[model samples]
Target: KLQMTREEVLHDIAELTSYAKEHYSTVLFSAEDATRSDLNFLIKANQIAVENGATRINIPDTVGTITPNAFGYIVRKNYEALPKNVRIAVHCHNDFGLAVANTIAGFENGASEAQTTIIGLGERAGNASFEETAMSLYALYRIPMNINTRKIFPTAKLIESYCGGKIKIGRLQPLIGQNAFAHESGIHAHGMIKHARVYEPITPELIGIRRSDEVEQIVKQSIKLGKHTGGHALKAKLEDLGIHPTNEQFQKIFNHVKSFGDKGHEVMEEDFLAIVKDVMGELPEEEQYVKIDELTVLTGSVTPTSTVRLKIKNNGDQIEKTASSIGVGPVDASMKAIVKCFEPMSKVKLLEYNIDAITGGTDALGHVSIELMDLETNQIVQSSATHEDIVMSSVLALLKGLNKIMKDKNSKN
Candidate 1:
C-alpha cells in the first residue's frame, strides 16, 4: 500500500538494512505487486532497498498482470536504477497464464534469478512452472543452468501423485506430457522414425527421460490412418515392427490402407498388424492346408454345436471335408469341429487358450492365443489371431497353430 510516503518507506528500509548488516552478510528485499505500482515509486522503493545494503531485490508480479514487454522494461529499469552490486530477481504468478513468458522476459532483460514452483503449484493459478522455465531457458534461449533435467518428468510424476492427481500434466505439455514426444500423424511419425528431430523439438533423453520400447509401441499403436496417411509412413511403421513385406505385398497392404481411408475408417495399429498377418499367412497352393471354407455354430441351453467345412491342399490336390462336434462352449465346439475335419492329421490337443480385449468398446478388437501339441510329432506350437469377433479369433488362432504344425511335419519329411 502507498499508505506510507516514500520517505517513510526509505526510513524503514534503512533501519532494516542497519539491523541486517550486524548479523547477516546478505539481504533480499521483495517488493510485492511492484508491476502495478507507479514506476517512479517502484524505482524509488527498490533504490532505497538497495541503498540500505540489500544484496538482492525481487520484483514480483503479485497479481500476474504484467505483459512480457512490460515486465522486461520494468526489470531493465530496476537494474539501471539499483546499485550495481544489487542482483535483480523475478517472481511471477500465472493468473493470466503469462507467468513463464513474463519471467523469461525479465531474465532476458537482466534478472539473475526466477522463482518457480514444481508443476506451478501455488496460490490462485500458481507460480511459473519449474520445468517450463528451466527448459525454455536452456532450449530456447540457449542459457544453461545447473538443473538435472532428466529428473524433471519423474519428479513431476511424483509430485502429481502426492498432490492426489491435482497437478495434471497435459499430454501436450511442453516437456513432460505423454504426447510431448509422441507422434500420431503418419507424416510426422514417418519423419520422426527416420529423424526424430523432424517433429520433436528436443530428444526426450535431453531431459534425462529415456524412450523405452513401449514408446515405439505406443507411437505405432497411435498411427492415425486417414487421408493424411502416407505410404512411406505405413512402410516405415511396418519396418519398425520388424515386419518387412515384399514390394508386391507392400502394395497390397498400402491399397488396403487407402481403401479403409477412402471409406472413412481409421486403421488402428492392431488392425493393421492383423491385416499384415493375414497377408503374410498366404502361401502357395501346395503349402496351404487347414483353410476354413465355412463355419457355423449353434449355442443355447443345450450343448453348443459347431459345423466346420475345411479345404485341405496337399501335393497340389484340394479336397473339402465337413465335420460336426459339440462342446461345453461355442469356441470349444468350433475347435473340436475344426479338428474333426482334419481326421488323422488333426491328432492335436488344445493345451491352452487365452483371449484379451485390445481396445475398449462394444466393437473392441479381440486377440486370441492358442497353444497346440501335435500328438503324432509331439511338436507344440503357439499362435495368435486378432479380430473383432471373439469366436472368429479363436478359430483363426487354432487354424494358425494347425498350419504351423503341418509346415513343421512337411519340413521333417
Candidate 2:
C-alpha cells in the first residue's frame, strides 16, 4: 500500500536507522513483504540500515506467501550483505500453514532468530506457533534450547485462557491437542500396548502427561474405544471398567458392542458401562425369551408401514412370528408392528419416546430412549438403543424396554 519510489524508500531507511542509532544502541530493520521485493533492492536496503547503525535485519513473510526455500534464500542474501556480527532474523505467518517450516528453513539457512507467537496466534492466519516450531527443533533436529519442554503445554493453556475465546487452540493442534497423545484405532492401540514407540514418535510424558509402562495404566490414560474396537482394545476397556465376563458373555457383549457401533460412536466410558449393564443386567442371554430376528420399514408415499420378525421361546418351544402395521411414521409403524408381534404373549403401553442424534450428518448415530409399562404387572421400565437408522433405533429401544418388563413378569414364571 505504500507506493513510494526507490529513492524515497532508501532515504526513509537511512533517516530512521540514523535517528535510532543516535538514541538506541541496537536496532532491527524489517523490510515488510521482503519476500516479494527485488532481491538486490532488498539487500541494498538492508545494507543501508546496517551502515546507519542497525544491528539486526528482519525478513518478514508479510502476506505469508513465500515458500520455505524462497524465505531461506532471502534471509541468506540479507545475512551476507552485512557484518558477520549483524544478527539475521525472520518473521513468518501461516497463511499457507507453513510458518513453522519457513521458520526452520530460515534458521537452517542463515537467519538465527525467528519471530513466533504462542499457539500460532497473530495477524491474519497467525505467526509460527512457538511451541510447535521449538519442539520441531528440540525433538526432530535434536537441537537443545533453553525452553522447558514439559512446561510447553501449561504455557499454551495459560495463553489460550488469556485469549478468552477470541483465540482457541485447535483440538487437532499438534502436541497440544486432546487427541494428540490418544491411541484409539484397534491396530494402533494394540501396537501401543506392545510398545509405546511403535505408535508414538515420542513419549507423551515429555509434553506433561504422566508416563505409564503398565498396559492397564496406559490404556486408562491414553486408549479410547470406538466403532473400530478390536478384541484387544475392548478387553483393555473392560479391564479398565473392572468388569469380568465369562468367555461366552464376553463374546456376546463384544458382538453387541460391534452392532451398537453402526454409526461410529466413540463409546464414552459411561456408554461402555451402559452397554455392559444391558448385557450383564437381568435377563441375560439364556433368559432373553424374545429377540428381534429381522425388522424392515417402508415409508414416504404409500401409508407408512413396517414389518417385524421376532424369535420367541415359550416354555421350551421355539417359534417365529412376523407382523406388519401402519402408523403416523416409519418409526411409529415399526413400533406398532413390534407391539403386534408380542401382543399374544404380553401387552405393554409406551409411556414415552425420545430420540436424539448423537452425532451430525444425515446418517449419524440416532439414540432412541423409550419408557414402557407392562400392563399385566403395572411395572414401568426404561430402555434405550442407538443405530444409524431412526426406525431401527426406535424398534431396538422398544424391544429392549419390552423385554425388561416381560422377562420379569411373563417369562420367568
Q: Cα lDDT of all candidates, in order? A: 0.80, 0.83
Query: 1-413 in candidate 1: lDDT tens per residue?
Result: 56987688778888887688678888888878899988888888777777777898999999999999999999999888876778888999999999999999999888989999988888899999999999999999989788988888888888888987656877777788766775646678677666667777777777757663344643564345554677767776787789888877787777766665566555676667766776666554456577999999999988899999998765456789899999989988999999888865758889999998765556655778789999887889998876667889899888888888888777876
TM-score each candidate. Answer: 0.65, 0.82
- Runs of candidate 2 with Cα error greater than 4 angstroms are 158-167, 209-217, 248-266, 282-284, 298-305, 325-333, 349-394, 401-413
Worst 10 residues of 1 by lDDT: 212-221
Among all candidates shown, the one with the greatest TM-score: 2
Winning candidate number (lDDT): 2
Pairing residues by index, what is the TM-score of model 1? 0.65
